[model samples]
Target: MMDANVSDQRLRHQHQGLWLVAGIAGVLLLAAASIAIGAEDLSPGQAWDAVTAFDPADNRHLLVRHLRIPRALAALLVGAALGAAGVVMQALTRNPLADPGLLGVNAGAAAGIAIAIAFFGQAEAGAYVWFGLGGAALSGLAVYLLGGVRQGMNPVRVVLAGSALTVMFLALTHMVTINSEAEVFDQFRHWTVGSLEGRGFAALGAVALPIGAGLLIVAGLARRLDAVALGDDLARSLGSHPGRTWALAAFAVILLAGAATAAAGPITFLGLTAPHAARAIVGTAHRRLLPGAMLLSAGTMIVADMAGRMVARPGEVGVGIMIALIGGPFFIALVRGRRLGHS
Candidate 1:
């Protein structure tokens, strides 16, 4: 018996090590591809040199450093935040379909941006960050209230509440958009279709702290979340406080999801699918699952961005469009096949 247990532990450790190696390799490959493939392609050598050797006169190098690099980083950050948020959300709600977009968080951020443009005369995407964050926080609170979270909400109730809020916020956004001036609508229109283009270090800088803080909160709560995943009674028996875990999870979701939306304009379905993919690869352990999802998501975002550039040539499609094209089918398949209640 002792020998069998030892063998199992060794195999588990080996599997984890293999996943770690593969994850790092995947992120590196995606990052390199993102920097190299665009309107103007760069050879792998050139891309590596652009990062390693600085030259002010080389326009190719400048484009890599100033444009592609920032966009790649933004995609990485946004994907990571969304991926981590998705895992935490599914675990907390016990709903496989629970995601930032499905739960009304992204819609809330979009509504916030509309409000910022219409009421406050905010034009720059960076200027709307706080409003987006505020909206996400409020909408999350509203979902809990509507879902009767305190009354021990189940997965169906939670999703239903989220769906209701999503509709409400989206409707509000449309009304604000239609009533607003043409220019505001034009700006809002571009933002509503999520993209990683036109983002700079400034946008990244704005959301870094919030997203980082959220990740930390999730990490601290990960074990308790594992307990919670087994259900409330078992979690309490294991000395985990479900209420506190839920509150912290909510705050983390707002920070991560809001920051991603504010940075990337409410990209959909990455959160919905990333965690599922991660689970397939890394199983249910949050320690592996969170980072695994991040890498998978970041890689997917990079590939989507690269594909967008390829599919249209000089007239590139947006990353959001590419994600929707891919994720929409995935969503439909999931809905058609999966049982919709608690796991």
Candidate 2:
């Protein structure tokens, strides 16, 4: 019995270490690929030279420095933010299907971008950050309030409230785009599809602090989240305030998911799939799950972005569409396979 227990512990530790290593390696590989491979292919040597010795005279070097670097970095940070938000959201809602988009964060951000384009004449995504944040915050608040912010909230009600709000916001976004000018509609349409094409360091910088702060807050609340994963009464008995913990986690989710969506135009399925994949690899422990999901999501985003670059050659598919193509099926499989009502 003792030997069996010892062996199991050793295997668990080995698995944990392997997962961490694999996650790191996957992220590094994807990052390299994202930077190296684009519309214009360059040799490994050229890519390295571009990174090491940037020269304005060299188009390859300029592409790497001015475009790929920022894009790759944006994908990484945005993926991380969304992954962390997903983990917290699932924990808070006690629903496996719960993602950042469940509370209309994506729609809210889209609506904000539409408003910015139509009303404020803001053409750039970086300029939409503030409006997106405001919209996300307000929409999230609306969902929470409508879902019963009072004590002993029901997860089902929250989900229903979010679904309704998502529809409403999406409708509003559609109406705004339809009535807006052709130029504004074109820009908004592309932005809503979610692409890393034109995004740069400035776009990433706009949301970096918020995402970072949200990650820190979520990290601190991991244990509490675990407690909340149990029944609310049990969590309270274990000295975790379920309501407070959920509220904090929800706020963090808004910050992280909102920033990611605002920065990159709502990359879906990453938040939904990343946490579940992390749970499969690292088990339910948020300590490992959070970072694991972050790495996985970052890699997934990079892969999707790379695929978008390759599939159409010069034309390129949007990362959002690529993810939808991948995630829509995964979502269906999950629904068909799992019992999501009582996660």
Candidate 3:
């Protein structure tokens, strides 16, 4: 019996390894497709050459090099960041349905961006990144403090606090939007839609540090997160510091989700859907789960972005709109089908 159990475990591990490799391959393929399938069609060879070589005289090469490449990279990086942050937030709260956006992280970031544009008249992407990060960090701290988890942190309380805060920020955002000048509102509308258009490598460069640091922190904590899944007291007994682990996870979420939102505005449901889909395919072990979630998210976003560009026939549907269209039903189903705490 012992030998049989060991063999079964090994087989499961092998299967998981296969899934991870396959997922990563799919993401790469989707990214390549995204680059090739934009408005101006380019053969794979041309696109490859365009990306590699520089010719100021060649408009096609310049477009591919300066536009599509950076846009594709932004989609991949933002999707990966949101996916990884979603997994961390879900694990930290022990709630399968938890999403970074739903927990006020995105709202806080959006609010910050809106305020910056309305007051400062500065709507630049680089400046928005800092504002968004600051807002998200402050909101997350507020949620944690108000959630009232004295004996031990309760997922429900934290989620509730986050939800309330989200509602408040969203209301404030709308108020500001409504009262702002037409020109400011016009600019705000574009920023809110979440497009990958016209972005350069510099936008990706801005997020590299925070996203890289967050991913490293998450990777190192994979084992600890697994222990956390065993319950707080048990995790502590096993020599893991639950409080410190939770704080680190929260910080990771802020850095990742904030930067992504700042880069692409608010993308609805990628975080919620991606991690849950990954968990459904692979069981709830953090080590396997995080990578699967990241790949799935990256692939999903790339596909959605490609579809949006194609479906609109010259005009493109913004990524935010596409995600919302797909994510709305999924979110409802997840909420309706299960008891609140089961996740």
Candidate 4:
């Protein structure tokens, strides 16, 4: 029995290692493809040369360094953040359909941007990041407080509170937009769709610390999350502190989702679909699922961004719009196939 148990553990470890290797390889391949394929069309050799040398005097090198590199990094980070956050939320809530957006994080960020634009007249990318992060943190805290009633933070209550908060904040944002001038709407409209265009390394710099810290926290809490998944009472028996676990998970989600939302506007469905897909592929081990989900999310976003660039000819469909277009139907199908409430 001891030998068999050891063998089983070894097998699981091997399986997880395989998934990690595949995920990292996939991310590298997607990153290379993202840099090589774009509207301006640089050959693989040229792109490699441009990236390696990165000479400002050469237009190709300059564009690759200043534009494509930053945009690709942003997409990769945003995707990873969304993916990790999704996995954490699902584990925390034990709800298969839970997503950061479902908890009003995205809407809160949007409302923050709208308020910033309406009052402060600061539309800069750097400024938007701060506003978005503040909004996400505040909204997430509100949802947690409201959800943590009665016995504790019930998943259903959290979802309900998030849905209600999202609606309220969205309504407020709409009202503000409606009352404002066309110019303001025009500015907000672009942000609402979400894109990585015209953004610099500065945007990435602002989010690096928070995202790094969040991913580290998520990594440390992986075993705790796994324990929590065995049901609250069982997890408690196993020595897991459910409240502390939930609090850490919540903080990670806010850090990740907030940073992503601040960098790009509220991207949809990546969070929901990535973890679900990862689970389907690799089973429910949080250690495997978390990293797998992150890679898959990054790959999905890079592919979506590439498709968006190609589909519209000279014009591009921002990543946010593309995700909504793809994720909406996927989400509907998922909801129909599974009784999410019961699950």
Candidate 5:
């Protein structure tokens, strides 16, 4: 019996490892495409030469070195951040539809960034990440209080509270932007629409720590979440603290979402869709699910960003718009499928 169990565990790891490899491969391929295909297309050889073989005179080399690489990294990091956050949130709520946005985390982060720009004139990402994290924490706390933890945490009430808060925070963001200087509006507008136009390594570096910390927290919470998903009573009986799990998971989500929003604004649907797709590949186990979703989302974001460049040509569509165009249909289909399944 012991030998059989060990064999089963090994097999599971091997299977999950394969999916992880596939995810990595997909992201790498798309990232390469992201660097190579753009406003001015560059061959893979040229892309490499741009890095290895220097030519300051070549505009393509400068574009590759300065623009494409940074944008791709930003998209990849933000996508992975949101994807990981989404997985943690869905597990906590036991609701497949639960995303960081459903809890107003993204809106709060955006509001924070807007406030920073409007009030403090701090427009850099370093300031954005901090203000964003602060805003997210406040919004999450509001939801927690309104969510009725004293009576036991109800996922439905929490979601509703989040929905209400999201509206309020979004309005607050707009009010600040509208009331501020026209320059603020111009800057905020670009970010709000979610573009990757001129972001560089500085932007990525600003959010990396928070995002990394969030990923670490999510990883620690995965097994505990597995226990919690079985129900609070069952989780406690198994020696997991469901309350602690919720607190930590919520913190992790806020961290991830805030940092991502700080980097690329409030991107929707990637979070909601990535987990479901990962589940199909890795089943319900979060250890596999988190990485799978992260890779899938990272690849998807790179693809959406590249496609945005292609569709608009001289003028490009925002990555946010491209994502919505893809994810909106997927969301509709998911809802329809759920309804049909229930019926």
Candidate 6:
């Protein structure tokens, strides 16, 4: 019986390993498609040569090398960040429906961007990203305090707090930008809609550190998240600090979701959906669930980005709009179901 049980465990691990590899390959394929299928769509050969050969003499090659590749990479990073953050949020809250956005991070980040563009006269993403990150971190901190996660987590209270904060931040953002110049609002407009249209490698590099740190934090906190999911009392008995975990997870979410929002404007629904979907596939193990969610979310982002490029033909739609359209129905269905009531 012991031998049989060990064999079964090994078999499950092997199967999961295979699934992880397949998931990675799938994301890579989607990313390749994203690079090749933008507004100035490239042939697969051209795409390959753009990366490998890099004929600067060819305008198309320059477009692919400088423009498409950076945008695709940015999408991948943003998606992975949102996905991992979502898993951490849901696990920390014991709510499968819990999204990082529910912490009001998006609103805070948007508000920051608006202020930067309007009051500070910052136009570039790199310039405003710090303001965005600051806002997102503060928002997450406020939510953590208001939700009383350290005292005791109540999903209803946390969601309510997040909702209230979101409204407040959004209203303030509008007020801040109401009298700004046309150009300022124009920049804010494009950002609020969440486009990958013009993001260059610099923006991608700027966000990589925070997102990478956030991922590392989440990856390290996996077992702690699991213990917290079993409830604070049990987690304490198991030698885990539930309160500390809550704080760390919130910070991690701020880092991940904030940097993601910094990179791409608040792309909704990806953060909410990825973890829930990953849970269905990977069970409740935080270790497995976190990475699984990241990969799936990365693939989703690439596909959404590619679809955004195609949906308007010569013109392009923003990735944010595409994600909302795709994830909106799923969100509705999840809400209609019993998941929200309990978690």
RMSD values for the candidates in order, in angstroms, are 2.6, 1.9, 2.4, 2.5, 3.0, 2.4
Predicted candidate 2 versus true structure: per-residue lDDT over 154-230, tens digit per residue: 78888898899989999999999999889999998888888988887777788888899999999999899889988
**Cα-based lDDT for every prediction:** 0.83, 0.86, 0.82, 0.84, 0.84, 0.86
Ten contiguous residues with the weakest lDDT in model 5: 334-343
Could you tell me how far off, in angstroms, the CA of residue 49 lies in candidate 2 after the best superposition?
A: 1.8
The alpha-carbon deviation from the true structure for residue 320 of candidate 2, after best TM-score superposition, in angstroms, is 0.5
Query: How large an RMSD does model 4 have?
Result: 2.5
On TM-score, the stronger of 2 and 3 is: 2
Better of 2 and 5 by lDDT: 2
Listed in order, each prediction's TM-score against the native is: 0.90, 0.94, 0.92, 0.91, 0.90, 0.92
Candidate 2 regions with alpha-carbon error over 4 angstroms: 331-343
lDDT of 6 at 13: 77
Give the Å error, residue 292, model 1: 1.3
Deviation of model 4 at 306, angstroms: 1.0
Report the lDDT of model 3 for residue 235: 95
lDDT of 2 at 193: 87
- 2 versus 6: better TM-score goes to: 2
Model 4 shows how many backbone clashes?
0
Superposition error at 191 for model 3 (Å): 2.5
As for candidate 5, its clashing pairs are none
User: In angstroms, how far off is 162's CA in candidate 1?
Assistant: 2.7
